[model samples]
Target chain A: MNISAKQGERFAHAGLALLLLGLLPLALGPYWLNLVGKYLAFSFVAVGIVLAWGYCGILSLGQGVFFGFGGYAMAMFLKLEASAPELPDFMVWSSVEKLPFWWEPYSSLTVTIASIFLVPIPVAFIFAYAIFRKRVSGVYFAIVTIALSMTLVVLNIGQQGETGGANGITDFSTLLGFDIINDAGKVAIYWVEVVLLLTATTLAALLLHSRFGKLLIAVRDREDRVRFSGFDTAMIKAFIFTVSAVLSSVGGAMFALQAGLVTPSLIGAVTSVELVIYAAVGGRLSVVGAVIGALLVGFMKSYLSEHFPEIWLFFLGGMFIFVVWVLPNGLADLFRKILRVKA
Target chain B: MTFRRGNQAPRRKAVIPAAISIEETFVTFGIFVMQLFNGLSLFTILLLMALGLAIVFGLMGVINMAHGEIMAMGAYTTYLTASFIEHHLPGLMGVYLFIAILLAFAVTFAFGYVLERGFIRWFYHRPLDTLLATWGLSLILQQTYRSVFGAQEVSVPLTTWLSGAWEPTETIQLPLNRIFIVALTILVTLGVWYILHKTRWGLRARAVTQNRAMSSAVGIDTNRVDALIFALGSGLAGIAGSVFTMVGSTNPGTGQLYIVDSFIVVVFGGVASLLGTAASSFLIAQMQTALEYLMSGSMAKVAILLLVITVLYFRPNGLFASKVRA
Candidate 1:
């Protein structure tokens, strides 16, 4: 395809995506709108997965740790706001004499917002660097991430007095004095999420089409060759991992705001792996495809679990096998092939 | 300090009273000894699971995420056998445990063989894809078990001979079941070692693992080797699962509890060495047990995980990794 034709197709695609998202609020009730917002929250993680796992070849099975870091930060702020002048209910129940030092910073909205990136970005960078710097990749790297996520889940559950344990930081109705549970607030949050999602998708697209993205693909295909060419391959891998971490953190913060709670279960190994499937199903190489994948899969899961709870896993698991075996490049590729689009 | 239960309460810095009793000291000693045995039993289970994982990974470079589910298959097989013996072969109750172990191995071995032939062979070169695919298979298997056996946990009833503990000391009652599990692990380990070293198939397996092209050129059916080794590794996991029933109840999700830990054992031991897998499992199990004595169980697990990741940072190939050209 020529440049003008390709650009025209891109515009058409973006226009369709916008129209679809714009129609949801008008077409659906408050309840379904809220659910799509949750799926949009997850798409952020899926986008990050595309960059890190798809481009950089780092299959981190622990993105949930970063997601939780963002989520818990947001939750702490909301909880503190809800229970101002007194400890959060769980803390009081657990007989904590004073608010933990970590919880103090979360009382401020600015600090809480900053913390979504401030904490997880550094941790993600350091963790990814530590492993990639030593040339650990592939299955080993994946397993290490799994262990990391598991550790976080255990630690979060173990520190019930401080972290809200398995029940998580729920029972919060307001965010910055705005009643979040109301339908108006829910619709507002949904639009805000949609705007943010579009912004992230565009930014990710720009990044993936850049020279750095080319280098990332090179590193994925042949890291040793990239290293031999004087590139610090570890730094390259870590950078994208950290970038993906940032996206996941933002998604997680959104998740807390929209979902009304953040729990340890949201950041366990199982959830992390599930996050990867969102990218895999969408087409790991396509930014917008990942968003659609998350929405599609998320909708299927919600609908299936509610209606046919017994067989949802069968469907989900079947999708995984089918994607690996047949639809390796995901739905985007299938669509492209059907349309006879040139790569 | 004299009246304190050893390893139960965390140590405090407060000065101890001088009126200590010898019996109290003996009890503390006994508890410590019991903790060590507990670690041994955990180490055995980890080793069994990791042995199969390491072997499959080393030979074909395929990550079998369903290996844990395969182990669960063994546990369920044991559960089924126990129920069958209870219903039809009541007179053979004493020997049923032994029969179940062999049956579990046979069942999972055949399952592994079919799984590899049907699914795993396609992704031999795509290790990461294999990981995700097998993970999907694991979820499918877990759901299948849940549908068949229900979500509730099932336990294999121990024979009359296996139920009681040995009173090594007045305070230290070592469970007979745990001791039996440890012995079973040792026997299995020796059997695996003997097969790998003495058998012609073992030679062919090692040859293929070391250099597949050469093995193929030398007229060894490398695909057959791949299938057989995969099955054997799965059979080892089956045995591990069978033994697990004596220690804990079997649930559809039981395999998930061990999958991450076994992966750690395989990675921490280095992917290439069987001896490394064993050593790492022993190290991790002991470290976790010791840490649990000093802190909460969850914290202990976190500490071990952090320690393993930290160690991997410096030694990515694992602590005992043999030098390979890659």
Candidate 2:
């Protein structure tokens, strides 16, 4: 039934999302543009949530883990570039005369850039295969993913020699040998980030409108029925989950470039859950809504905290409760209401 | 676990004038025993927290994500009661500890009652939604605590009676506070077992848990049962918060720190079985302590998490899964 609506809705949503993406870089000032780029990076994870949670009924609270992996993968190369002829700062401080074995490969530009996609995808694929194949899902899957992110954060902090410990990888001067600290570099990274964010959402929209997407919804709603009808439900779930992880990894990578650092805090339970909240608030079922939701929440947080810092948590908490209990569909539903009234 | 026997035994011969074998064995045994004691104390705390979670998630099938914050509510109440005693009723300082535990339970029970009626009850059919909404509720409660108590952690003064330790052997010492917590866990476990098994309310709760429609059709007040059980679970958390003061300190964020571990315990124990939570909490806490001895703290945690994830993959229902129809 939704196959037809999804096809039309996909194009309509993609057009709106792309139009906003097109307008943002031209409309905003440099500071806000850069800020939006960070939020857009977050949208990468939100789009993942829409596909995995919204379409396939698999909620992962470890998107940050994948994001962190992607960012750190990129950071390793950049850190190596910045500190050429020497080991990365933390590794050096931990006191070895020579560079670590793992850090050696990241010195190459090809491996570093390829790792942004290559690293998170295969790791996510294996993880999804293990968990989803065993049919551990729903709240259990969420818990496992959260545990994964929390474990990664702890691992990063513990291996101060390799990953920079508590204070994550930083001091980046170049990406692909371009001076990333300067204005032009920041703008270049920001544009690249926005484009990636749009591309991810576009891909998500297309996936959701496809035949497999319809089957995903069926599996979500009635797993036993779908299984009885002869679907390889596990593979479908694993595929979607891996895709979500891929999207988050891209965001994490861009985030490192834009923010100039990647910290363990980015991959903690709090960050992972916050990403989920973004998707929920944006309208979990809609691809573009998740992206907009991430940006809106980021803006609200920065804006609200600046004016009334004390009240921001209360507001965030209230929004979480309101979105989950009252408006499960989020701002997208509200937009529909407004549009209906205007029509 | 330790591979120091051969070298250490010879060194003991040179260092000690007394029986080297006995002294050496005692020394090694003492360290392991202490870790075991510490692990047990950790287990007691996890059990207290997980018991509440097990009740709500296992029996009720509602994921109350605000559980840790609710536990914090209990801790905060204890902190407040402690302050009030210190300031106003100086004579009752020692006695106030027991009163504070009761107060914490009563206070959070009332809050839980209201919360169940107002929010959680409406979302019983939707477990995942309950999780998100309760998480939001947790944030609100956390901010509320910060606003009220200020951000700094608050520690309640220990009652003189519960402040000391007992040493059965010459080498091994067990703190009174930890023993007190362990005793409290036993008492609560018995109380929960009795409430869910022996009483009329327990029967109704069991009926509701097993088959809500049939039970309701046969004239059970499922709604009241739901509210009371939730309150009971929350009250248990409150008591845990009160006891938490005896062990360490409380902050607005105390509950948040423990909530994840509490969730892990509940899931590890197997949802729908109180016995499962008890067993899993003990296993997890002990494993954590034992691992810390072998590796760095963070790596120990990562290892434990990996182990649990791997275990959950194999036994998806957990260590002691209860048979139930979805």
Candidate 3:
């Protein structure tokens, strides 16, 4: 397609972004590369936050529910594959005589993949419809999401036989004949995850750069004014929230593939809140900034927990304070001066 | 943990799927009473935390996640006071808890004052910023506690008067501390209610809550009111923590444990209504206690939270929401 000079410049920036992403796999060794692959998965969730929180102004503290949903779905599929010719181990342990009919669909790779994309849409829609229809906004929405997430975690932990308990759905062996535990396999999955993350980021950028995106911001700033303008504000808010949830779910599914285990802890209150914090530190409003932020926070968590275990919490906490007080816009905004224009 | 485990008979029945006998029904009826008693102890903690939360979240619109840390500081203060009594003032060991409660209030009140002046003031009118900053402060406080006091849970030596239970019936024995806590919550709630309804400070606080600009215009010094009411809320949380030491052990992360639950209670009850908060905490505690007998611990929690969410769906403003909230 022919493009103008301004459009060409934008494409160049996108190309540069891809180039930087490409350089990462080359520079890092296999282990660090795999670790970064995990971070890249997290960026998928962060990118979702840029849309949900930054644009829609709906801070979903419970996105982990969708994340966990995608993860458990992926893990179930992998578990079914690994268990080939027998039922999953948890079901066996719990003395389940028959394979649960519900899990039958996951036996097919196509169903599993489709579910990774589809499950969160209905879940987000129902939740958003219930609350947003009533015009619940701001902190109340946050509390609702947090409560939902915590409920999912508890449900996962409690339903051990059906859902694999607190240890979660683990012992994944392969994904579509790709052995995930090997070093070569790790890099393969890492690339796959990185690509998915890039796709997610691109999707978020497209949404954020659209007129729908500006309307989302308007709803955030003045809901009454926007509603008075004859826009079905609830539908717009619900639609964005659903998209964000589905994005997070894909991230969670990818994370399950990379990490080779999906636990309820991933869907807990703390992890969900941390996702938001990473998005905030990256620049909540900027899609690319959030991806970088997730990587930085993930690196800090791993690096700090390794070298300075005791100081890690303080450091992360301090980062939270620093981001809030000194850099309200995040590390993303710092480069805004050099760019000399808003993205 | 104790409340969750205390009623094991109900748990065994819950795990057994579905079967009930006439004798078992009679026992279940008694157990319901027992669960209700156990619920009082749980409710006491919820009420204590929810009251302070109502003041901060409902009245002021601050998303102060560190409110739990303030409560934990109070618990730590009690632990310290009890230790001090046992070590230095050996003769006053019996009287230490009273002093501990008072000291917890003063310490947390001052801490809240400093926190407001330095950190909270900077983030005024920004709920999201306030939320993140307070959460950061919570992590810092939790780590500081871990550094200073170590990670393990510690119990304060209870005075003999506070220990032991009263057997009001053959199968039901209620812990004295829990009964005392319920009584204490009543006293605290009444004190808060009276202060909000009757006194000059309460008037100023209410005026500011209803309309900040108008309150300031009337020479009420709304900023001072914000700071004072916040400190009062923190101080109330401290007292809650002090009372909590009687029923539970104190640890660095204990605050984090209850922060979500406290928020749920306050929000589910209705943001600004003290009576609603009171009703919701009692209702939630009873549900949790009774449900624990029937399901797994996490499931019971999940069910209770689900119930709250369902309730919120029907009444998004909460059970007893004030009409004026933005």
Among the numbered candidates, top lDDT falls to 1
iRMSD (Å), candidate 2: 1.1
In terms of DockQ, the best-performing candidate is 1
Instruction: Identify the leading candidate in terms of TM-score.
Output: 1
lDDT of 3 by residue, A1-343 (tens): 4445345436544853665467777787778888888887788888888888887788888878888888888998999999988998888998887888989999998999999898788878977977898878888888878877877777878878888887888887787777887889888887777677767777676776688878989998999999999998889999999998998899898889888899899999888988988899988877778888988999999999999989988997898899999988787777664454534
In model 1, the Cα lDDT at residue A106 comes to: 93
Q: Which stretches of candidate 3 lie over 4 Å from their true place?
A: A1-16, A19-21, B1-29
Q: How many residue pairs clash in each candidate?
A: 0, 0, 0
Local distance difference test scores for all models: 0.88, 0.84, 0.85
Which sequence of candidate numbers ranks them by TM-score, best first? 1, 2, 3
> Which CAPRI quality tier does the interface of model 2 achieve?
medium
> Which ranges of candidate 1 are over 4 A from the true structure?
A1-5, A8-13, B1-20
The per-residue C-alpha lDDT of model 3 at residue B164 equals: 90
Candidate 2 lDDT, tens digit per residue, B148-258?
989998998888888878987778888988898899889999999999999999999999989999999999999999999999999999998888888878888899878
Identify the runs in model 2 with alpha carbons over 4 angstroms from their true place.
Answer: A1-21, A341-343, B1-20
Among all windows of ten consecutive residues in candidate 3 chain B, which has the lowest summed lDDT?
B1-10
**What lDDT is reached at residue A121 by model 2?**
71
Query: Which digits, one per residue and each the tens of the lDDT, describe model 3 over residues B53-140?
Result: 8998888899898999999999999999999889999999878988999999999999888888788988877887788888888988
